[model samples]
Target chain A: MSLSENLFYFLSFLAIFSALMVVFAKNPIHSVLYLILVFFALTGHYILLNAQFLAIVNIIVYAGAIMVLFLFVIMFLNLKKEGDISAKSVFVKVAGVVSGGLLLLVMIASLKSLEPYQLKADIKTDIGLVENLGKVLYNDFLLPFELASILFLAAMVGAVMLGKRESGERNF
Target chain B: MVEIITKIPLEYYIILASVLFCIGVIGVLIRRNALIIFMCVELMLNAVNMLFIAFSAYRGDASGQVFVFFIMAVAAAEVAVGLAIIVMIYRNTRSVDVGELNKLRY
Candidate 1:
């Protein structure tokens, strides 16, 4: 195996392991930390794919911002003891695992039939660079870019409104 | 770089992403904490992103990378609103457990 293939296997292992940890960790904070590790492993995969811009953005947006938000919420809630938080019935747990395993098997079977093809000659190599990506973003995707900003604005307003403590009579 | 990338078959990525997505699904189904479930959803999104970037590089197309950008933006917005809702739930219910918040399940 070449160096690149080795790197890919290592990164995939890290990502899968950390993702499992995120699910099984007793403390919510530990889950958040494991999620961060998964993101870092994903960033490594992005880099291996020659997507430098995406790798950096993944680090900045996911690991830097979103996870910190998660950590803040976990800490603010002060969930010191997470006793018996998962489902109690053994049947439900078994059913969930069975369903998820079935889904994985189906997806793998479908992907196994795909034929690998050689890269096309017209394929551009520098597209993953920041300059080329920026050109396409501003020139071809200008409208969607603006729309995304609007979406962010709406989300910010909605979050603030939902989180504001009520002072008047409660209406449930 | 593209040649080196194509040396590894795309099917490997497909398998990796499928596993990650299933892990996310199992996490959502089995875990009771709303915050942990939300994190699992993010995990699923990352799996999709990895697939997108892999295909984009394989095809030598930049559009898939751009799509990943949009996915990231949407994820950020979703997390903002979702976490705020989770915090509100905690304030009113004194717990982050989803099983206990069934007041609307009449």
Candidate 2:
């Protein structure tokens, strides 16, 4: 195996392991930490795939912003109480695992039937760089790009509306 | 650098992404904490993003990458609104457990 393949294997293992930890960790804070690690490994995968712009954006948006939001909510809620009825019944847990495993199997099976195609020589070279990505984003995808801004604005307004304390309530 | 990625078949990426997505699904189904389920949803999104980048690189098209960019944008917005809703629920019930907040059901 070459260096790149070894790196891919290592990164995939880290990502999968941390992703599992994100689900299974007892403390919500630990789950957030694991999710950050998963994002980091994903960033490495993006870099390996030559999507430099995406790698940086993934790190900034996911690890930096989203994970921080999760951590803040977790800490603010003070969810450290013990003996809460957090555990699901065994039947439910087993059903979840079985169904999820079946989904994975079906997806992989479908993928195996696809015809193999040769990698295009000139295609994978540097199209993922910020310069080329920007050109395409501005030209072909300009409309969607502008619409995303509007989505952000609406989300911000909705969040503020939902989170604000009522005028007459002082339950804290 | 292209040789490195090309040496590994695209199917590997497909399988990896599928596994990650399945883990996310399982996490969502079993976890009671709304915050943890939210994190699982993010995991599923990342899995899809990885597949997009991989396919884009394989086909030598920037459109896939652009799609990934939009997915990230939508995910960010979703997180903001969803977290705010979670915070509101917690304030009213003093718990982040989804099972505790089923008052809306008929």
Candidate 3:
């Protein structure tokens, strides 16, 4: 196998494994850490896809900033204990498994109908570069682009409002 | 050999991404921990992002990738607000179990 293939396989495996760990890890902090691993693996995949800019931004926004915020909240909350996980009824487990199995089956069946097509690596050198993305974001997607900041503003206000304590509440 | 795998059809990516998406759905269903469930949601989003990139590359257009950018933005906003809500729930109920938060089910 070529180096690129080997790299792809290795990175994909890492991504899947870390994603599983995010769900399996008991500690919230550990779960977040696993999520960081998943993001890093995704960045690797982005690089392989010739999206160098997306790769870096994925790291910066997800692994760097967002995870740090997650870590802060997790730590602030001090939710380290493995509290009672939940009352896991047999029916719930069965339902989860059956639904998941059905979804997978449907996806596989649909995918079987697609004709195979090869990708040429003839990527534009400008692909995923900051300048190119910026140009598109400003030109073609200008309106939605401007509106995103408003979305963030609304989210920030909502979060702060949610964090505020109720007048009668005793804790937190 | 390198070229061959690099040129593997878009179908492979679609199948792989679909599998990941299904698994994420399962995780969301099975896991009761609020944090784990959130991670599952992230997993599902990433799976979709994979599909988007695959299609973008296949179509020879960057627009799909641009949509991926929007998805990322929405995801970031979601994570920020979602985690805050989770924190608030935890603070109030001292619990993060989905089954416990039944006030809205009515």
Candidate 4:
């Protein structure tokens, strides 16, 4: 009925469609491209929710950097040859459907039973802005913030070591 | 157009995020490609980030936004390292099929 609603619906549809393609696409490159689409749609959703900083960062980091790496690696691997088994067995298909259906039912039932609470009209639109987020990051979440950086450093070293191909491996 | 956004309830965002999360789970289950599985993982993370942002916006608290920041950082690091590992696996085995990499089975 409204522009925001229309935008939400449009982005949501794109997100779901691209997500489906991420799974269904036969080529890994295409899968990465669809993932990029999903990330962009999510960035739009973030912007609509008043997280302008997140939207920009999401595009810069996800759609820009991470997806490029995904594409690069996919290309480097030369994995153009489709897998031998592209189709799933009927049993796995049934199990996947059943599990997803069950989870959906549970979520809907819980949400329905929980009464909605009225929120205060006071909004903090600047909460997600870079400056405000940075303040909170240092003030309230300082420990976790520092720890996360350490984790990233460790992950970086680990990845470099892992990706370095070993010289020899004799199969017994 | 700007006036219409104020009327939107936080529940709508939560519901949408839940749907996205579910789709991610389905993708993880039904697909075998390592890269796609990685994408599904990212989808799940994004869905959770949406929920956090929605709740933060509704409560007028900045904590949720901080968590989203942390989630983004972790996700970026994860994708970087995970993709590198996946590339290594592909090079070693020459296959990215999930079912084919079941060597850890007991």
Best by DockQ: 2
Report the alpha-carbon TM-score of model 4 versus the true structure. Answer: 0.93
In candidate 3, list every pair of residues with a backbone clash: none
Q: Which runs of model 2 end up more than 4 angstroms from their true locations?
A: A168-170
Interface DockQ of candidate 4: 0.58
What are the lDDT figures for the candidates, one per model? 0.90, 0.91, 0.78, 0.81
Best-to-worst ranking by DockQ: 2, 1, 4, 3
Candidates by TM-score, descending order: 2, 1, 4, 3
Q: Interface Cα RMSD for all candidates?
A: 2.2, 1.3, 2.6, 2.5
For residues A1-172, could you state the per-residue lDDT of candidate 1 as single tens digits?
Answer: 7888888899999999999999889889999999999999999988888899999999999999999999998888888787836454788778888999999999998866777666676777678999989988999999999999999999999999998988882434
Lowest-sum lDDT 10-residue window in model 2 chain B:
B1-10
**Tens-digit lDDT string for candidate 3 (A1-172):** 6676777778778887887778667788998998899889878777777666677878888888878988887788776676646756889878997999899898899777766664556745345666777787788998987789999999899889888888888684
Clashing residue pairs found in predicted model 2: none
Minimal lDDT window, size 10, model 4 chain B: B1-10
Residue-level lDDT tens digits of model 2 in A1-172: 9888998999999999999999889988899999999999999899989999999999999999998999998888888773454678999999999999999989988976899867866665688999999999999999999999999999999999999999875445
lDDT of model 4 at position A126:
70
**lDDT tens digits, residues B1-106, model 1?**
4455666887888899999999999999988999999999999999999999988988888999999999999999999999999988888777889999888998
Model 1: runs farther than 4 Å from truth? A84-86, A169-172, B1-3
The true-versus-predicted C-alpha distance at residue A158 of model 4, in Å, is: 0.2
- Kindly list the per-residue Cα lDDT of model 4 for residues B1-53, writing each as its tens digit: 32323667766776778778887888889888888788889889988988898
RMSD of 4: 2.2
Task: Flag regions of model 3 displaced more than 4 Å.
Answer: A118-126, A170-172, B1-6
DockQ pick, better of 1 and 2: 2
Give the true-structure RMSD of model 2.
Answer: 1.3
Q: Taking the candidates in order, what DockQ does each have? A: 0.66, 0.77, 0.52, 0.58
Question: Tens-digit lDDT track for model 3 on B27-106?
Answer: 89888888778878988998898788767656566777788888889889998899989998888888778889888888
- Consecutive 10-residue window with the lowest summed lDDT within model 1 chain A: A80-89
